[model samples]
Target: MNNQDIKAKETTKDSKYIQQHLANERTFLAWIRTAISIIGVGFLVTNLHFTMRSTLSPLGNQLATLIGLVSVAVGIVTIILSAAVYVKKIKDINNQTFRPPVISMIFLGVFIIIISLIFGAYFFII
Candidate 1:
């Protein structure tokens, strides 16, 4: 058979799971968007702190900077973890052995809780 025929065959094979693959891609993109948003929030917090430095006490300024840096780091971790999950899901999908994500979800939940507590303390106690 010609190259075109072989290419067509491969496409047809992959097309069998096109919907699943598309869904996976959409999920990955969503994760990417979430990461970007988290990063943006981090930068916004840092910038706000810098802009209002004169009004904020030294301790408050330091706390804001720390929170901003932590936010950025969390965002970076989210991206890395999401990419790993995406790749694993892709492989599982192809192999027809997909499993629900557990560890990552738990990790994220804990992170959110910690961050929320930090924000609450910063707002109420600081």
Candidate 2:
């Protein structure tokens, strides 16, 4: 094939794979949004301890700070891991070996549940 013909063929191949690439981009953006939200919540929780210290017991403030730090840490970890996963998914798509994303979803669900329990305890028990 001539150079122009080879370039046209490659473009066609890429066009056929565009949908998967777009889906990967969307997933990456969603993960970014999730990470930002988690970090924001962490900041809110952390500040609440200081703002409402008079009403909260000392132990309550401590618990809030701890939870906030953990949340922030998890958010950072999520961003790092998501970036890695995004890269892996793109590579897999290019190689036609993409796998279902089950483990990350399960981990996210459990993380949300645990965070919910922490917030419930903070509001009701502490």
lDDT against the true structure, per candidate, is 0.81, 0.84
Which 10 consecutive positions of candidate 2 have the poorest summed lDDT?
Answer: 7-16
Judging by lDDT against the true structure, name the best candidate.
2
The TM-scores of all predictions, comma-separated, are 0.86, 0.85
Name the lDDT of candidate 2. Answer: 0.84
Worst 10 residues of 1 by lDDT: 7-16
TM-score, predicted candidate 2 vs. hidden true structure: 0.85
Off by over 4 Å in 1: 1-3, 11-13
Give the candidate number with the greatest TM-score: 1
List pairs with backbone clashes in candidate 2: none
Q: List the residue pairs that clash in candidate 1.
A: none
Model 1 agreement with the true structure over 1-126: per-residue lDDT tens digits: 999888767755446688998999999899889989988987887787778756787777777888888888878988898899888887888888998879868977998998888887666634
TM-score of 1: 0.86
lDDT of 2 at 109: 88
